[model samples]
Structures are given as C-alpha cells and as structure tokens.
Target: MDEQTFWELVDRTGPDPANLERLADELSDHAAADIRDFADHLARALHALDTPAHYHAVATSGASFLGVRCAAVAAGNRAYRKVLGAPAALATYTGSPGDQLLPVAERAYRTSTRADWQHQTAVSTHTGSNVAAWGTSWLHPHMGTTTVEGLAPQDYMIALRHVALTLDADPAWRSWWRQSGLTACELGIVAEGRLDHLRPSADIRRCADRLRANFTCASPHGGADLSARAVSEVRSMFEVIRQAMSMPGLPPTPPVPTLPADVPEVPVTAKPLAAMPAELEPQGYLTLTQIQEFFG
Candidate 1:
C-alpha cells in the first residue's frame, strides 16, 4: 500500500497487535525485507530518542552529534517556515511558539522547501547567522551541567564555522549569536581557532562515537520507506526503550477527528449576501458601512 494509505490504516486501526500481524502477514514472504527495513528504521529512532548511549554522546559529542548533527532540527524547520508564511506551518503555529517549537521545527523540516532535513540550513538562511549557535542556545538551557568533556577546540571550531559562514548572508543572526554567550573576543577566538584547527589538549568526538556505537540500545533513525507494521513494531520498541530509560513514551497517534453527522453545514450567514455579477464585481465588497446607505 502507499505510505499515506498505510498510515491511514494504522491510524484507524489503533495499533492492535492483530491489525499489525495481519498487515505483516499480508505482505507475504516477499516483503520480509521491507518489514525488517521498516523495523530497523523504527528501532534506530528509539535508540536516538532516549537510551544510555544517546546520553553518553550528549555528554561527550554534544546534542548535534546524536542525530544529523543538531538538536534544533525540529525548531529550525518550524521557525523557517513560520518566517516564510508556509500555509501549513502558519496554521500549526497559530498559538504562541512556547514549548511547541520542536514539533513546529520538525513539521517545517518535513514540509518546507528544504523538506529533506536541511533544517539548520533553512533556519540559518531564514533567520540569518550562526544557525548552529542559535540551535545550540536552545539546547543549552536543557543541557544542565552535562558538558562535552575534551570537546576538541578543532571540532568545536568546525562546528562554529558552520554557523559563522552564515554571516555573509545574515549579519543579524551573528549579532544574536554573540549575545547568546561569551564576549565578542571569545567568540572571535573560537572562530580563529576553528580557522587555525587549534585544540586545547584532546577532544570528545571519538569517545562519543565509540560510546555511541558501543551502546546496544539501538541506532539513529534510518531509511524512509517503512511499512505500517514496521512503524507499529518500531513504536512498540520505542516504548521498551522509554520504559528502560524512564523517559516519557512516544505519544499515541490520535485518530483524526471527524465532523459529526448531526452538525449542520455552514450557515448561510457565513457566506456573502449575494454573489456579485461579472460587471458588478468591480464595485468591490460592500462593507457594513456601505450597505447601511440602503437603509438610510
């Protein structure tokens, strides 16, 4: 089945094991590879969202090292689309950004012109300057004292350059980045160090990578095309991971709400009083003030 159809079936079926098993069997032996691929994709995602190795990486490599090199992937996507006036993005961001920022960013990444996970790139260009710094700032408040020990000044510089290069496109973002922390000189040195490939003593990346691979929990998300059963099984595994880590489980996908049969269609008053003819259309909409003239 098509991805949308598969998702719709999943939504309507509510992940009943029977439903999943039936779906799985329907695929037949020919589809076993698809099942395994889909399952692995989910298993990997479970590993990334929580798990001990994820934190190990967080402690050494920083949040960016966990996924595709940035925790703000979700936020960047939303902020970029919100800035661009994307129809779907605007609809979702109607309320205050508040805690919903991450989901917004995720959706933005899924829907924006750069729908392929180039979130920081979009956020960098859209907001202008240091997308990394901006993204890192968002992570800072939540990171607590878990600093990446021995984070090589060189790797750090490379990360900073990723952000600093946006300067030519957006000086304002850089101005904002500098305000996040460190004096201008400090930021300058970081930039210079990045240019010079300097290091304080050692680095954190290798350690983090080692721990990341060493952890048996799972791995980062992989492969896009997934069967519904694979999604279900993956999410189920995610539950296991969540329980193990004492992290909150993934929220259950709610079935889309439908209009009740008893509910009337839109009332006449909601529409215009009359449809203007072709010639009369040029007169324009008759506002309340203009319509009042008739009564007078």
Candidate 2:
C-alpha cells in the first residue's frame, strides 16, 4: 500500500495489540508486495525514532523504549510528526506495541495468501541507543585496567589515526566510536593489544575492525537485510569493553588527553527557543509562573 494508505490503516488499527487479529484481517486484503512494503515502511519509521535524544526523551532504558517506539508509529502520521518536532512529547506515550506489529503483518500475509511474508529492508526495527551518547564509556566494561604501555607514542598515534579514519568514514560509526571512549587513543591501543594477543596470526587492523567484523557477521537481521539487531548485539560487545576499562589496574586516563588537531571544539551553550510549542503545554490557559516552569 502507499504511505498515506498505510498510515490510515495504522490509525484505524489503533495502538492496542489486543486488536492485532483485527489489524491482520484488515491487512489480509492487500497484495503480498504491498504488505511487505508496509512492513518496510513500519521498520523505517521505527528506525527513525531510534535515536539517543528520543531514548532520553521517552524516559526509559534502551530495552524498554522499544515499546514506546512502536507506540509512536502506531499513533499514525500526525502524532509521529509531533513526536519528531518535540521529542519530549514521546514521554506521554506508554505501553506501545514493541515487536508485535511485524509478526502480525507476517501472519496476515501468510494466512491470507498461504505464502511466506518476510521483512525486506536493512532498516532496524529494534529501538534503543546503539551506544550511550555520553557518560561512562561503553568500553569500560570489557577491557578492565587494560592499557598498552609499551607501544611507542608515535605508534600509538598511528594506530589512533588509523582507527579514527576508518570509523570516521561513517557518521554513525564515528559517533559510536567517540561516545564509547575508543577515540581516547589508549583504548584503541588496548583493543589492538588485546586482539593481537588473542590471535597472533590474524591480520587485525585495529579493535574497531574486529568490532565492525562482529557487527557485520551478525548481519542480515531477520535474514532480510542488516537490521537493527546487529547494533543491539554489538552494544553488548561494547558494554563489555567499557566495563573492562573501568577496573582498578591501569592508572586513570589523562585528565587532558591530547586530541587530534583536526577535531573541532564543540562549545557548550543552549540555543534559545523562540517559544515552546502550544501542544506541549497542558490544556487550559497557563499562568506566568507556569510558563516559566515549562521553559525553565
């Protein structure tokens, strides 16, 4: 079905999975290709909502936010747009269908046409931050007190540069690398040392390569395309690294570790908003103090 028609069906189906049977019945009439297209659109929509900011706005852990993401899509086009405009508005949604919709679509396709239905997109349906945006490094869990002390400063720099350039090619991968503290140079050194020590004969470029390999090997999520499952799985690998780094063996990282000169300094400041959207405010006339309460 077309995008407009798809959303209309979603709205008519409503957010409650209790009525999944009804939704399946409604979708049963569409062509199998249209049903698959509908699945792809739904997958993309879920992927779009899977962002660090949106995760934070939803006020839930990465795992729990899956349901919330589904709810946003199930709410239909207008509500989805509102959530995009004011991410915090997603906080208002609760108990949204998580992974239920796709299966329902699949079941509908299968039962009606007596044929298999499969998701055919690289877009991820899973919701959650692939990695935490800031704070304690995800690598801290895996490489405990691990530091490569013997590598020459120049050699370490070379490795760091290589890792940076390799991951920097992709914006999302680069963000994941930086946020997990891999860009610290020392972590990259540790990762390389750990990998090389683990497999002496392997031609390992750096730890990032190994991580990327792991992500790739876990690919073709749901046997369709590279789905979000890879990211969710890779996140576990990252968490282990982050934990390992936090153990009490190596000295703490330099308070002022040298950063690459090419890296731009991001100034910390809030961009002032002209006004809060009217929809965000509670219904009824708001007083001056209440207005300050909302803005402040």
Clashes in each model (backbone N, CA, C under 3 Å)? 3, 21
Model 1 over residues 1-296: C-alpha lDDT tens digits? 23343334334433223343443443333233333333333222223232212222222221222221112122333342243333223223222222221232233323333334332311211121233334332111100000122222232222222222222123333343344243221111111112112221111111221210000011112342222322343334334433543544345432211211222221111112234587663332333332222112
| Runs off by more than 4 Å, candidate 2 | 59-63, 127-296
TM-score of each: 0.19, 0.46
lDDT of 2 by residue, 34-110 (tens): 78878877877777776645655643322346667777877778999898777678777754544577676788789
When summed lDDT is taken over every stretch of 10 residues in candidate 1, the lowest stretch is: 211-220
Clashes of 1: 3
Q: How does model 2 fare in lDDT?
A: 0.47
Worst lDDT 10-window in candidate 2: 212-221
Model 2's TM-score against the true structure = 0.46
